[model samples]
Target: MTDCLFCRIVAGELPATVVLDTEHLFAFRDISPQAPTHVIIVPKAHYANAVELAQAAPALTGELIAAAGDVAKQDGIDSYRLVFNTGADAGQTVFHAHLHVIGGKPLGPSGLDLH
Candidate 1:
């Protein structure tokens, strides 16, 4: 999807404060972070949403979760929140599938509240 924002980021067409990158995943700082160390880990392959890809590709799913853990460790947060806003009701702004790893404080009810 050429119009996808995350695809652009994965392709390096858009500038992002990247935290980590692997053959299958790209982890970068969220432009509108919800925590002090907020990273969005996305797969290189485009998926519409979490539910759509959760079981379709096991390897990709494992890689995504691993990347989130790696990012949390790198951010030096003992604990972090991993979130996947599946649909519009969950507040997913972008259609691309991504895992939000946010920490660096006692995460509140709303995820992290970077503010």
Candidate 2:
């Protein structure tokens, strides 16, 4: 986990535009944001993905999700997307467990894409 980028971010070893932070979770803007307000929520403790998180820390998992909701409301997004890419097949570039809170404007042809 030493090489995990999110872990570094959580540890303050890397820099990110942090929006929120709790005892166990951290939320920051994604460098390659999919939406106008794309934030990534991550746990301070490292885990590979949702499956791992569900097993290792179920209570914190709920807390992280609740935190995401708080962030969404604060960001002025009435309807947003919470995405958890499970693995490489699901477009998960970062190995650590995280949730993407995407909203604000449309993208792609239909104005619904995040790219």
Candidate 3:
């Protein structure tokens, strides 16, 4: 896990524009912004992906979702999109479990064509 990018971010070894930091979660702006307001919310604890995190810590998974909602409200965005790419084939460039909160604009349909 030492080489995990998200783990490094959580440990303060990597620099990230932090938006929210709770005892169990850390939310930061994505380095590569796909939308006007894009944030990546990750658990302080490392998990390979959504399935892994949900299986091991269901409560934490729920907290993550709630945190995303809180972030949307804080950003004053009533409509937003939450995306979780589970595997490499699904465009998960990072292995760590995280949620991408995208808003601040009228988004188009999310499809493979976009990628």
Per-model TM against the reference: 0.92, 0.89, 0.94
Clashes (backbone N, CA, C under 3 Å), per candidate, total: 1, 1, 0
Q: lDDT winner among the candidates?
A: 3
Mind sharing the TM-score for model 3?
A: 0.94
Q: Which candidate ranks first by TM-score, i.e. highest? A: 3
lDDT of each residue in 1-115, candidate 2, tens digit only: 7799999998889999999998999999998887888999999899999899999899999998898889989899877778788978777888899998888875434333322
Task: Give the C-alpha miss distance for residue 76 in model 1, angstroms.
Answer: 0.8
RMSD of 3: 1.8
Over 4 Å off, model 1: 111-115
* Candidate 3 lDDT by residue in tens digits, 1-48: 899999999999999999999999999998878777789999999999
- Candidate 3: residue 33 Cα off by (Å): 0.7
| Model 3 pairs in collision | none
Per-residue lDDT for 47 in model 1? Answer: 91
The full ranking of all candidates by lDDT, starting with the best, is 3, 2, 1
* C-alpha lDDT values of all predictions: 0.85, 0.85, 0.89
Q: After superposition, how far is residue 15 of candidate 3 from its true place, in Å?
A: 0.6
lDDT of 1 at 15: 100
* Candidate 3 segments exceeding 4 Å error: 111-115
